[model samples]
Target: MQSHARGHLVYAASGILAVHTERGTSIVPANRVAWTPAGFTHYHRAHGDTDIRIVFLAPSLARLIPDHPAVFLASDLAREVLLALTGPRNYDDTAPHYSRSARSRLLRVLVDELREAHEQPLHLPEPRDDRLQAIARMLYETPGDNTSLAELGKTIGASTRTLSRLFRDELGMNFYQWRTQLRVYHALVLLADGHDTTQTAYACGWANPSGFIAAFTNIIGTTPGRYRTSRQTTTSGRSAKSKV
Candidate 1:
């Protein structure tokens, strides 16, 4: 757990990154960007061979964004700007140097782009209640567990009604909804590691690939197959470029 003096945006050019804080975890795939405000204790874990890019924002610009941790869909413009700001120019002296005014303009454009982009539902809020935490721990340990909430409640010595209420008040979602998010988070990690869609679906607790595809699409805005293919293509392209 660490905190930064300046707020920063993290983009995974390839692979996946999970940002964990007191609030919860935010899953950042290639199509998304994760923002962590200054002074928020957080840690990151990368899945597969990840290419991570980070751009720190000044206080003046950080105020334009949400104060809390969030995940946002990365538009094409946002992606390009992020890549430009954090790209190889930092280390390559032969590359053109951006003037201070030019860099500031780029930062403003990046902030504006983020302001217009939609906030993604990739954040999984942390559960404060002990029972809820227990349930979360169980699920996190085994996302494939198909146990009902009532049954899970029994193991934790809480009535189903009590657990349901806590789920609403504490987590802001029902058991199934939270579980689905958890499953999708796990599925992303699995996919990043090169697992097949069918195998990932089963590993993440989906009864069938179709159901997993629907839920994955609903949250991620892309099919698992397409996402994997894109990652593969990006990796191959990078490899070929490096060989040149």
Candidate 2:
């Protein structure tokens, strides 16, 4: 989306969301929310049948949030307030004064809840250098490619030392860290699409299921199997409700 004057909180009540911005990309599942500061050009892609919800914040409310894009764990209170504020028929200019007042109160509570929630490590920082961008793009396109950093540097005509420095300076992370994060991001998508852990591990470049599970759990706060199970449950619940 084009940059605009208002910052917003993007939450998915039912499924996962992937938000791309200048800084990098962030993956927000059911338990997380992504924030985009004012004037940030960004777009979102849903991983499943997502219930995308948006809460626009005015300048005063926006100032209480990060100046850059971020992702936070959505607490129970935050989720409730967000659902209330974004419910069907939430906004009505012709509505009664009490209705408007109730919405305002709900919005305030949502902001307060977000202010206290802990940020999630869901961001993948982008590198500014052209050479690094080439490398990143290649890996992003082929997450299963087990290419070494040195091998990638040769193809990109940059020394391993230079590439290492660029990754540290621009992204504040080592090559392996960034790659692992990318793999984890891909794993989330794969798992959400009903891929098993072993299949996802290989798809994301992990040599073995154990290694992939460890890395996935470390970054995502849950095992891939459990995450997949949760997604299954959510889908089933939605289906059951639809049949009713």
Candidate 3:
């Protein structure tokens, strides 16, 4: 776990990134960007061959974003701005220098785009209660576990009613909701690993690809097939450009 001196935005241009802070884990896929406020202890885990891009925000600009960690939808303009700000100019000495004022303007545009964009539901809040934590651990370990909450409660020595209350009070979501989010998170990692949609769906605990597609679409705003294709295309494009 580490903290940054300034708030920053992290984007995964090709694969996936999970930004884990004390509060929760925010998933950053190709279509999303994650923001972490300054001094927030966090760690990142990259899934697949991720091309992670980070842009730190000045305090004045950071104030425009959420104080806590969040995941926002990356609009086309936002994505371009992020890429330009962290693009080749930073490394290729022969490339024209990216002027500070130009960078500042890009940052402003990025922030403005984010402010206009919707915050994604890619954040999985951490469970604080011991029982909730145990449940979280179980689901995290095996997202495909189709265990019922009542059955899970038995092993944890908590009644279903108590567990339900804990889920509501501590996690702010019901067991099913939390579990779905966990499953989706795992599905994303699996997809980024190049798994087929059918395989990913079943692996992530969905009984069928249709159900998985519905849930994935509901949360991610895209079908698993489309997401996979996009990732593959992006990776291929990057590879082709590298060969140039």
Q: Which predicted model would earn the best lDDT?
A: 1
lDDT by residue (69-137, candidate 3, tens digit) is 999988899988776766562332222347889878888999999999888999999988898899899
Candidate 3 regions exceeding 4 Å error are 89-96, 237-244
- Compose the digit string of candidate 2's lDDT tens values, residues 17-112: 899999999888876889999989999888865667777887987898789899998888887676556553332222223376677777778888
- In order of lDDT, best first, we have 1, 3, 2
Preferred candidate (TM-score higher): 1 or 2: 1
Q: Alpha carbon lDDT of residue 29, candidate 1?
A: 87
What lDDT does each candidate get?
0.87, 0.81, 0.86
lDDT of residue 64 for candidate 2? 87
TM, every model: 0.93, 0.90, 0.93
Model 3: which ten-residue window has the lowest total lDDT? 235-244
lDDT of 1 by residue, 1-244 (tens): 8998999998877788899999999999876899999999999998886767778899999999999999998889988887677655232222235789988998899999999998999999999999999999999999999999999988989999999999999989999999999999999999989899999999998889999999999999999999999888654433100100
lDDT over C-alpha atoms for residue 110 of model 3: 94
Flag regions of model 1 displaced more than 4 Å. 89-96, 237-244
